[model samples]
Target: MNSALQKSSSIFRTAAMQVRHTSVTRYIGTPPQVRISTAEKCAHIAVIVGTILAGPAWVLVHLQDYKK
Candidate 1:
């Protein structure tokens, strides 16, 4: 039992050391800027808003069935 405990503790220590080395992140530089036309911007906003509202709209439309 003592040996098993030592083995598990050693395994956990090695895993912790590996995790410390792997979690490093280096930022290179600023990302490039993107340019979009007014129409394209409007389309993107419309799509995003539509997606956000679709779920609630669906639930409201089917709320009676859910209550039943």
Candidate 2:
């Protein structure tokens, strides 16, 4: 069991590292052609926040409906 857990964590660490490398290489290395303004940046942030919130919102709605 200990060995299995160690192997799982090792695999996860490798996958996480690969994802980080890919994201940096794909986005961090690129220069933006049209730089986003502050308002645009705020909007993008809001969209991301809303996307994250949506999952919880859906779960809450379902729970409410289930109680009815």
Cα lDDT listed for each candidate: 0.90, 0.92
Range of the 10 consecutive residues with the lowest summed lDDT in candidate 2? 23-32
For residue 47, model 1's alpha carbon misses the true position, in angstroms, by 0.4
Q: Model 1, 1-68: lDDT tens per residue? A: 99999999999999998888777544346764777789999999999999999999999999999999
lDDT of 2 by residue, 1-68 (tens): 99999999999999999999988786565687888899999999999999999999999879978788
Top candidate (lDDT): 2
RMSD over all Cα atoms, model 2 = 8.5
TM-score for each of the candidates:
0.50, 0.45
